[model samples]
Target: MNYEAVIFDLDGTLIDSMWVWEQIDIEFLQKKGYVIDEAAINQIEGAGFTETAEFFKKHFNLAMSVEEIKETWREMAIKMYVERVDLKNGAKEFLEFLKAHNVKMAIATSNGREIVEAILEKHDIAKFFETVVTSCDVEKGKPHPFVYLKTAEILEVAPSRCLVFEDVPNGIIAGKNAGMTVFGIEDAQREDAKRRAKDLCDRWVMDYNEVIDILKE
Candidate 1:
């Protein structure tokens, strides 16, 4: 695909940090005397950071306000992101390839600004992107197309000329809804997610290496 700008969803797409969330969810909910389940986790799959916090508050009937809930999760997840999260396989190389080709890039993520900034700064790849937009920056989250469209707008790229890389079905749908082509990245923990993402995305790949090879052609 010929594209001008490349927009990435951060968690499982640009970084190997999805596991950090899974672990945080387990530990957080367990602390509140609740057991996290697949159904509960699925409920917020593509939701933004604030939206996810709201879900936790409503579903779990927690006494905390949305902001407090977010703060708690942030505290729980930040150290993990800063200490353990790394770029996806070949992600830096692909970013360099895009930079060399002068293809504009940006991040459209559901994660909060703090976590996103920390991880990007940790990898020193923040320089590659023109902008980094969180779901909080938009009115709505994935499956709504707002975040992706917002990123494209900020990049000053038309939706049709932008390419999105996402790892989840809702995110793929968001890119498609924005009238952009999307490539789905495979998630090792969820085979079902891979099938769903494949069905939704324009293309699917195991890692950024495949994308680099294709773009090299």
Candidate 2:
């Protein structure tokens, strides 16, 4: 019952980052004279920067570059991740357990590399993963399967032999579409987020602490 590799989604899964995205999105739109609420933020949470920017452009009629949208979003999240958003309960302990067990680990996140690295380093958990796959590194992001697929390929592990822990529906679908077993995590405060994704995930758990037990089963 051993898996060869473990792939992780950064936000919400490894850390309490879901609600922060809403804040960033809402603030970014407000600055441009647009109003956004829970419904608006939920619709864009799992999308890549480009997709999210496109949504904003169409919704608010902005002419901003995707990079600009990404930069502005990162500007809000980086400080929060660094100054706040402590690792989810048992995330560090779980990482150490994986390292001790010699589990091959990688991060496949829709977050930009700059922000991802900042959070990982700030939390002192960057060394646990062998690779960090961000949206910028791939032509496609989550819910498209490219990022998770590329990660398993880079780790030289069969898709079926890898397990993915994700907090968003997009990421759950991406992992399952890649032929990996997906475990969904949730944040109680983020009620607007989809708890299901294309009906492809294997199991839904509330925290990372439950991962080891699932793997054993």
Candidate 3:
């Protein structure tokens, strides 16, 4: 794509952490005497942790504050992210290739900073990223473009020179709204929005290997 910098969304794009969220949601809700069905899960697929927490509070009629709900979800998901999550297929190789080629890389994610740092440190690839920005750093999350813009600003890269890789509709729109080229990556959790996601981006790929292959050529 001839881009100078790359921005990645963490959960489904670079790391296999969506399953961790699914597990946390199912377990947490079950413990609270409520079980969410697939349709319910789909509705909140691309939302940020805080948004999801708000949904939980309103839909499930929970009495917790948004911050409290977010913290609880974080606590439930942190152990899984630190211990069980791994990079998406071909993610590490592609990241290393970018590093070798001197392409600036950064992460713009909706996840909590603590969990994101822990996972990156565990994978030993934290150094590859020039900045790891979370939605919390900005006033709004995905679909708003604030986080992605903040990331590009931190890397001192022009929005037009940055390419974003994302797995969800909100994130794809965020990159486009930031005036950067956006690419969609497949993630099973967002299967229902697969076609929509592809339509929203400059390109779509099933995995990082597909992107790497194209970049190499």
Candidate 4:
């Protein structure tokens, strides 16, 4: 388990911001005279920011362009990310440990760059990461391996030497697809979803503290 670089998924994995998106989805659809449902949410589960917007426009039959949809979500999300979001328990400590070890780090997130930057700065943890790559920076999002591959490339690390921390099945698959070891970070997902994630990842943990303990051994 000697990984030279670590890549993380931002939302549910690194921070407790997944709830923000769930709320945004409900409000956004309500504003558009549509209702949010399980099916609608499932359709964009592993999508990148742009891909999610595209899905929203098409599936919701909204008149807003993809960019407009993205803008609306960004506008609704930025304040929450900057003010309300916090890192998951033990995340900062694990980050500090990694930094002390001189391990390279990066983010491969489906979230927009604006909110990601805002939250990173808000937490004052931006210095811990060497790079941040959003799904918009690549051709596809999670489950496709594009963003993960792009991040490893930016870190100048081979895929085999990289470790990815993810919360969902798609993100775990993306890391594995990139030929990196994947660790599943538990989030607020349903039991079934958590089981699926565990099945896909090389390891699983409820928080970064568990990882720190393991590494210390």
Q: Which candidate has the top score in lDDT? A: 4
Estimate the Cα RMSD of every predicted model relative to the unseen true structure.
1.1, 2.3, 1.9, 1.0
Model 4 Cα RMSD, 1 decimal: 1.0
Measured with C-alpha atoms, the lDDT of residue 143 in candidate 4 is 88
For model 4, the run of ten residues with the poorest summed lDDT: 37-46
Per-candidate local distance difference test: 0.90, 0.79, 0.86, 0.91
Residue range 82-161, candidate 1, lDDT tens digits: 88888899999999999999999999999999988888889999899999998899999988899989998899999999
lDDT of 4: 0.91
Residue ranges of candidate 2 with Cα displaced over 4 Å: 37-45, 189-200
Against the hidden reference, what TM-scores do the models get? Answer: 0.97, 0.89, 0.91, 0.97
Estimate the lDDT of model 1.
0.90
- Relative to the true structure, candidate 1 has a C-alpha RMSD (angstroms) of 1.1
Kindly report which residue stretches of model 3 are placed more than 4 angstroms away from their true locations once superposed. Answer: 37-43
Clashes of each: 0, 0, 0, 0
Q: Please write out the lDDT profile of model 4 over residues 1-217, one tens digit for every residue.
A: 3889989899999999878999999988888898887887777887899999988888889998999988888999998888888899999999999999999999999999998988888999999999999999999998899999999999999999998999988899999999999999989987887899999999999899999998888
Q: Model 3, 33-55: lDDT tens per residue?
A: 99987766766765666777887
Clashes of 4: 0
Candidate 2 Cα deviation (angstroms), residue 180: 0.3
Report the Cα lDDT for residue 157, model 4. 97
TM-score of 3: 0.91
